[model samples]
Target chain A: MDTKTDLLSHHISQQFNNELEELRNNLLSMGGQVEKQVSDAIEALINADSEGAISVCEKDTDINAMELTIDEECSRILARRQPAASDLRLVLACTKASTDLERIGDEAAKIARFAISLTEQGEAPKGYIEARHIGNHVRQMVQDALNAFARFDADLALAVAKEDKSVDREYKSATRELVTYMMEDPRSITRVLNIMWVLRSLERIGDHARNIAEYVIYLVKGKDVRHIGIKRIQAEVFDQ
Target chain B: MDTKTDLLSHHISQQFNNELEELRNNLLSMGGQVEKQVSDAIEALINADSEGAISVCEKDTDINAMELTIDEECSRILARRQPAASDLRLVLACTKASTDLERIGDEAAKIARFAISLTEQGEAPKGYIEARHIGNHVRQMVQDALNAFARFDADLALAVAKEDKSVDREYKSATRELVTYMMEDPRSITRVLNIMWVLRSLERIGDHARNIAEYVIYLVKGKDVRHIGIKRIQAEVFDQ
Candidate 1:
């Protein structure tokens, strides 16, 4: 290539790199916001703190805006830079991951809404114990998934996917226990239903975390592991 | 530009157009499959067809695979074509829309699982009538959202968003009725809970449809209407 063309190419590449970095930073910030939302919302639920729950709901708009900003950045990079191979995959993964993050924010808001409702009704029930346990697990999954994305660690991502199985088990057992509790005492049915919705939201947060992990795997390995069994994902990551 | 360069540009544009068309067709086909899944699952629930529910669960794998395929195609085109402005928006919208469609499939599977559970227990209860009503509304929303996507109709997309408000109202009323039934007759708590879950899945289906409609608006008007109120969305779309 000519000197002028070579210089131009270097300049474009630098600009593209800067754009990719900005996208990553924006995504990480969004991930952090989502993690805080999940934690705060769950804490509010466990403590029956309506004030905290209200704050979580209020922050959802910021999360939504962050998603749009990251999306626009991804689109801009795709259009202007035309990044190939890994760069393209990174941008795509960022875009997809932002969607999961936004949805996670939504789930957090759902939990917060339930928390507010429960607070209005007065006093926490025993069912929140199970929710707290599951909430911790799901929150960790979200944290690890975001870390995995930040480091582009396929192994960590695969581990996150495997961790979801335990969350599912926890969710199911919790649901069953709650059902039995409700069946025994008709008076607690309404309260238990609210707790059930909170559990459902936590379970969905786990699913979104798993999705984020899958995106990490895709970004790192360029293989789609979504909808595949955990054992297969294990084999794919370990055997490599 | 020289004739050769002009011709090359035209050829590239043609190839990009063809890829976009293929992506659209693939998306439409996936939409059709998802529509079938939602319909069949709800039908199975209404008819107490365990066999149909099992089939719906089985078909989820196919829908998931289709999503990955479309995702890969979108990434490939974005890398190769670097489509700008509206074309880039279309590709991004496709990727986002496919994610919603896949989740809708997941919700359908959840409903089918409930259907299977309900079938194993006993005959259909009166609460399922409410489920059927909401299910039909959710299914119509999905159909209209997909149609809006296919035709790139921002107006139709806006309408879908507005229609979701009614679905929300229907879901709320249905849940209240179910909860009352559960409270009134504790003997039917388990069965009623199952129906409640089905209704929740149906409500989520409507949410996904709304997300798809928002994507349609974004693709057509280059505005992000997510997390915005309906009045603002109307003003944004119509005031222009």
Candidate 2:
């Protein structure tokens, strides 16, 4: 076998293999934390739980710290092990995925801030219903994407990538509905805008999830599926 | 000098040095394209120029293509050259900065899409002024961040990071103003929401620029300044 194929199929060194496994474990840990944060942030909005929202904001620092730590580990592995081919791809994917996880944390924090604002204003409005629906969908995407990464399941990753379109459609519809409500009664604009921002954050969270899924596909298939149309990705994944 | 320091201070190989330079140049090209896209997108919104906005959308594919190319080059260098120390840091930073630049392109496209929607609906509203102001500031941040990357100037990177705070403030004021305007005239809610999305896009672009600046700091000082408080970053940069 070629050196790269050998490296991929067999461990170059036991310590190096352990390091790679540790990196993946760290990423999964960070992903799990972010998923919980997203769910909690959405719950805070739906239940108008300002205290819960504040606690979510407080948790973001820990998530951010985890990202930095994972990133440092990736850099150290690249420098020390000098991994090639598939190993290099795995390290690169970990680095990129951690960055996305951190941003997902930021999006969840934004949602929490909105929840706090909505609570201060008064009762959560009708828009909270739509926010909850979209938020749930996004949280699922994050979970599935992480699962796909854990298993190196290209099929699951492609599925997660495809789900982003429905989230976008839901977000657009929600925005339209919220805008109509605001036009009917201008006094509700402030509250509606808060919900709108929450939906926007959910939509972005979905995007980040899709990015992670794309990274998973890259890692498994040795292909860069980013920027490619979903149709093409589907074709490639199915063909494989 | 020690081996690591010597590697940092001298080229590992002439070809590797050229490849690194090529990566930076590619990033700068992507940055320049994104800067123009941002400017054009804002101008389209302010002037109600749907055609200009559509053109900006068309140009995004090129930026995405550039990002993929640079990313491949970085991966290739990592697998082949196995660069360590500062060199490895540089490649990692490029990989990240290219991702940010591509997302900045995505943000610009979102702005351009908003401009198109506003044109179809009616005349641009007062919020366009705020959007243009914020857009200009964000574009400048992208430029300054790219300049910092080009020169490896940690001071300029820190400055760019600090500038993000003002952009955030401006974004908040703009959102508040738009909401108030919508409250005053319910009929304007649709147009006002469009402008608000544009402002949100600008704010996100500022965040990406700040991220690039952080990468520059990391590249120069071997410090991962991400997630640290700006106050700490300021102290660190100045103390050096």
Candidate 3:
């Protein structure tokens, strides 16, 4: 098998392989933290657990720190090892994935903030079911995207992108429903607007997850599947 | 004087300097393109110029292509020159700056799409004035952020982040006003929602600019400033 068949399987030296493996492990650990934050934030919003929401916001710093460390590791690898080919792509993918994971953390924190507002305003939850549904969907996307990266599976990454489209559709439909509720009640505008913003954050989280998946595709195939249509991505990566 | 006094002035080899210089120039050129896209998108939205808006959307591919080229050069430099110290920071910053610039272009394109939708819906433009006001504000931030990067001026970069706070305030205020309008005339909800989405895009553009400015600070002072509050950032970058 070629060196790239496993990407991280073999390097010139065991030390280099250990460094790359450590980097990937650190990245996955960070992703796991971000995933927990996201799922907890959604739970807080759906359950109206303002204290839990506050904790989610407070812990965002840890996610930020993890990203800084990941970035440093990426730079350290670049400067020290100067790895080429699949190794280089692996480093680049880790760099890019860390950024997306950090952004997903930010979006989850945003949802938590909105949850706090909902609790403070003492409004009965307007869109909790929709939030929970989309939240779970996006959380799964985040998990799967990370799995794709861990396994170097471009096909699974493609599926994450496709699922993002469905999240977008759900976001839009939920938004439309919220807008109609605001129109019908007029008084519900403030409460509904908060939920809409939360939905937007959830949708953006999905986008960041999709972005990570795209980076996985780029890492494995050495082809940029971004901004290109999915059919084109599939054709370029698999069809050929 | 230290080698970092003028980061690009002297390196081990003159050829390395030229490569780094070319990379910086390419990044600035890409930034200029994104700056124009943001401004043009705002103008199209404000003026109800759907044709111009369409042009802005169509041209996003150019910005995406530019980003890819810059990223490739970053990888090339890392693999070949293995830049150290300030040079390494410059390469890392460019890799990051290009990503933010590309996202700014994406946000600008989203604004343009909303503008086209606004024209198609043929509403009387409920938030054009507010949009123009905030659009101009954020566009200036983008320009100044790029200028800071070009010069490695940490002080100017600080100002860009400061401006982002004001832009966020303006966004919140504009959103409130739009919400009020929706309450007053329920029928206006669709148009106002359109405008709200545009305002959000502008605010996000401002955030992207601020992120670029933070990268500049990191490039110059060799500090990570993200997630740190504005006052904390200033203290970290300049106060110490």
Candidate 4:
């Protein structure tokens, strides 16, 4: 009788593991799609490729569908399995990662919107260089954040967080440049304002990347480092 | 012997209930604090009260500390009790709601930053009314979302979602007004741009409220209605 009970427990554990494995794979797939969207959206704006921007917008449907599916799966696991400890944390992380990925999709859609406006304006001024520079920095930050999440690498996540400062500095530079362009010629203000919105979107994308990094810290250290100073988080997580 | 075992189970159940009660109260407290911060921040902007914004900033430290404490408590309950079904959902929802509150705090801080900038600009144009309109709308949506969460009212949550569209429409109006302001006098572009940022921030606050509402629907119906149209969600939850 004891042996039968043990066997039942083992079977249940195995099924839970399989379900968790499936969830992890699906979340990674969704992450990959959003990462691609961010880069494609940046490229479209820089190259003035309206087609690429439109394509990213079209692909958003798939990202949305995946987010919904993962959310449902996570809810099912919670309802049916009553996961605890590390297993529960994994499911919780998936829910959060799904929300972040969906927001990244929204950011990409925002970039695409800017691309449409830029195309309508025919051509942007020379200061477009500054905007692309900031975009590239933001895109790289997002890529590194996603990679850190995939590997559960705390150091990589820290690197992503540290890069956010530089992204902000670049954003400030881009803002100044755009404002100067608007001030130079009033006609340029319309196009420049659109570009500024794009810069704000990229800057926000960087902020989201920082948010993902904070989650990675939580996942690894079981600490809530968010809203606390980063210096304090590093001391608690690393120096300890 | 059976009676003794039942007594032990009852004691354990009571302990679990106490933990869940603490979690619920902590979430409500955090919700109340965050709700106040958002409203106060907008009020500071409208009244050009830097002191009010500063007060909000100072209170953020307390909000952040509360979030950390709640996160730790939830983690402990999950680790020790291994609650199932509705209990598990309650803990998970508490964690997610805590996160939303933290982000709401961030948005309030952002609104304060905009207030500082607007104050420095000395006087915004006659179009400040548009920003005020959207700010009021977003604030109401947030308040309504929190009310829905406290009562677990799916119907109230759906109403919050519907109200989000009106906030979006207000945002569009603010944009049109600001853009026209900038076009009329190029010198006013900087001042107008700052107001636009405030409008954008308020719009984002509405988005976060929508997120909270989505979680409310999920909590009530045990369905992942996120990414689906809000109308469908209302029908599915209330059409019975």
What are the per-model DockQ values? 0.73, 0.90, 0.68, 0.46
Residues B33-132, model 4: lDDT tens digits: 8889988988888888989988888888888888878887877887687665556666767777777788888878888887888887888555567767
Instruction: Supply candidate 4's per-residue lDDT for B65.
Output: 85
- Regions of candidate 2 where Cα sits further than 4 Å from its true position: A1-9, B1-9
TM-score of chain B of each: 0.94, 0.95, 0.96, 0.89
Report per-candidate TM-score of chain A alone: 0.94, 0.95, 0.96, 0.90
lDDT per residue as tens, model 4, A11-109: 356887678878878988898888889888888888889999899999998999998888779878876876665566667777887877888889999
Q: What is the lDDT of residue A197 in candidate 4?
A: 85
Judge the docking of candidate 3 as incorrect, acceptable, medium or high: medium
Candidate 3 residues B111-145, lDDT tens each?
99999989888856578889999999999999999
Candidate 3, lDDT over the whole model: 0.89
Sliding window of 10 residues with minimal summed lDDT for model 1 chain B = B1-10
Q: Which candidate, 3 or 4, has the higher TM-score?
A: 3
Two-chain complex of model 4, DockQ on C-alpha atoms against the true structure? 0.46
Greater-DockQ candidate between 1 and 4: 1
Better candidate number, 3 or 4, judged by DockQ: 3
Question: Can you rank all candidates by TM-score, best first?
Answer: 2, 3, 1, 4
The TM-score, computed over Cα atoms with residue i paired to residue i, of candidate 3 is 0.95
Q: Which predicted model would earn the best DockQ?
A: 2
- Candidate 1 stretches with Cα past 4 Å from truth are A1-12, B1-12
